[model samples]
Target: MPDTLASNPEPAETRSRASELMALHRAEKLLTVVNVWDVISARVVADVPGTAALATASHSIASSYGYDDGEQIPVDLMLEAVSRIVRATGLPVTADLEAGYGDPGETVRRAIGLGVVGCNLEDQLKPLPEAVRAVEQVVKVAEEEGVDFVLNARTDAFARGRERDPEVNLADAIERGRAFLDAGAPVVFVPGKLTDEQVQALVDAFGPQRLTLIAIPGTPPLARLEELGVARVSFGPLSQNVALTALQELVEGVQRGEGVPSSMRVLN
Candidate 1:
């Protein structure tokens, strides 16, 4: 687990206000949501004046814990990551709490205590109803906490490695999306195999007033998303992977007795 934020001097009022700022980020036009794993990356992202908010990538957190992404890391590790990022920057932070760490209400209660303004909860590992229940529980917690905590509920039916029919998955996702929205999720994230037509279909089906559509990596660009009526776009774990790739290349170059490029070195 990372260091605790209790060591810092930030007050409860400030944390609550930061949560509100994070909630407004969801209503903005074309916000850039970069995923960070630790304090350094979180601080770097916060320094970007235009960055609306920060998101935690579960894969990065898992890797930092010397484990894999799929339920290998403990909930404590995830909460610690959020706490570190929140302390590292004043920017509103949204954590990717994968599957809400099992229990719905307990997860939300824990997350609120950590000072996170928003979170991404997915329906990949659990059934649709279970996911809905989890989202609803989180939303209720957000309401009671007096924070505009944006709950981004993700649907992974398309990403799941199965021979299920696309129509069935789409119907299931749509139903889950509606339930999540009714349960207080402001955004519904669809993560895989989404075409322009399908994106349009979802937007039309859900309606703009009901829920915002969020696309992950492999989806079209920002322009295409706007054209397709997508409200938000996130890269998930791609940014962390990009940083890792750069580090790997730099290390290989050094081992080969080649000096690293000036652009690649951070000379602070």
Candidate 2:
């Protein structure tokens, strides 16, 4: 049977949400995303006053379901969790689709079907031509689906090249990021524990509001990023780690016979 999803018209609201997400990346202020894992986290973050959109962390979602990161969770299972989150709120969602579940175009088609208007598609250090072709495929799929999908194409040069010289990693990231942009990716995601000079170099290469980053321990401050014209900053799985840390502390306290803290708000 032919797929009805591919033939049907996309919802107007989904198109609008996609546009909104794209604008957030181009805004002067850095778009900060505290990545969510499930419906509860989605709702909690969506209710925040300034949260313009939500992003999913693949690592966090997989861990929540007892699966490892890197597409360890079944693609169908991941889609269901993402669908529940999409239904939980009206905010636009950009998912972390790690390596595109081994089929970049098909995975994005499924995500678009579930109301995901944007995604982070990692290169995983694939050959340069292969990675750029993946970005092109994602762009083509989004165009076919009739949505202005935000493709945050990620290059793992810095993440995977920590053992190499800093200059070597910087050049590689620039080369890959430029190719990804030329292939129609809206922004390039360069994730790692970056130094201030490294961030500036990337900004210089990609120009203002074209680079996205992950927030790690040594990353530059948000204000500094804004001054350098970064498009977005997201705390990947660390946000989930923070939440889990609190949960662990509460459980330990209760084990010592303490009651629930009086300051908790019933968000859910």
Candidate 3:
């Protein structure tokens, strides 16, 4: 059967509690947003005693399906992956619905049905107005559903070939960030090309209370991000790459008659 977010939807109390956990990250000292692809990874991360929450990596999901990222996967497939992840863990799972999948209102309704307490919507692939409209729809749906869904609005200006002109890129990011916030996004994620000064500037522009900064891949270390007043840090597909590298090494070692590393041996 094709996978999808549950049609029945979660109970009101469950949704509220999930939203609360997402909201609490704002005040917490550190929040590690790990990227998970499948139910196994989600379960493992959820079992981590100190993990704040879980997030899906669009690239990882797309790669898994032999496709490129950026809305390549159908909404049903994405929602199914999300549902499996939610079932694998008790913690809040943030589905990275690239470009909100389709119409904003329908996307929000479908996401909420999957029991997601948070989602990452990006403006890299869509026009600013369309992105803003989508965020607005998401906010309305979240509010009506009585779930404080954390909307992490991502601006891909820096990620999409705007590295040469720092000033222009930064300005674009700020403008997009502000638009999303105005449309009801509680967090602004500037993915890529964010320097220390740039990060601080975004924080200054948006303020810590109103907008949380989400750090993307290769941005900086968690300590530096915290120093910059970033509220949340995400590794995106880095963790998955690390996992792939480890597996490759393990396989190569075995093929070379080196045997598996003792550390990798089953505990039984």
Candidate 4:
């Protein structure tokens, strides 16, 4: 038998919110997730009338601290950002807890303590077996905590192999994804801009309700993903890129002696 995480299940209110976020993945309409970096983006997204929930993008959040992704920033700072965002809204917030901070047990405890109901646990640049073990630890603690936490298992084969070789074998993705799920991951997020066929293959291998896709330009539109039966779609760092690109353009215009766009100019 598994050890109890929490003597009692989550409070009624926390359980209700967690269940609703979990249901979004099983709903008829595709769950479109907008990944936020900080409180500003989080609040803006949370205020959207049609938004379902908020997720954090580690890349964006890390960059906000002048660091590259992949745990470049300290775990303390990262969780602090998560805490602020988690506190800013009534909706469920899941964080991109990169690589479980190298300790799945403590990671689970800290995440729950911060009021997060879900999180993405990546493979942490380790072999499949190691990642599976980490996932097991996380799942064990989560169940004991009785928070109904949702773990989105992320496979980094595409990213891990990009520097050495751009080729990402679908077989590797399948093997890792299945291993994680069998270890108790509720969702498998296959990142990168895979083809419609590759995306479909993932969904077929891991049921629509269990597969999560990271959206990119090459991928089909949001509606098409729904038609193809994906469970969740995330715009990881894309929103941040868009926001930064606009600011870059504004700076360039200023450098060119062009006045600020009237739309953004403050009128005293």
Which digits, one per residue and each the tens of the lDDT, describe model 1 over residues 1-268?
2333444324475466555554554453555677899888887776767887788888888998898987678888778777878777766777888887777567767776777777778788477677777888888888777767777888776667347887877777777787787788877877775767777778787765333344455666777766555666666777887888988998999999988777853522
After best superposition, candidate 2 residue 86: deviation in angstroms? 0.9
Estimate the TM-score of every prediction: 0.87, 0.94, 0.89, 0.89
What lDDT tens digits, residue by residue, belong to model 4 across residues 97-204?
988877877986887877788889888558878989988998898888777778998887765666544335577788899998899888988887777787788888
What are the per-residue Cα lDDT tens digits for candidate 2 across 147-202? 99999999999989989998999999999999999999999999998888999999
> How many residue pairs clash in each candidate at the backbone level?
0, 0, 0, 3
For candidate 3, write residues 136-207 as lDDT tens digits. Answer: 988898888888888888888777855458888888888889988888888888878567788888888877
Which residue pairs collide, candidate 4? 5-144, 5-145, 6-144
Query: lDDT of each model, Cα atoms only?
Result: 0.72, 0.91, 0.75, 0.82
- True lDDT of residue 107, candidate 4: 80
lDDT of 1 at 73: 89
Candidate 1 C-alpha error for residue 53, in Å:
0.2
Question: What TM-score would candidate 3 get against the native?
Answer: 0.89
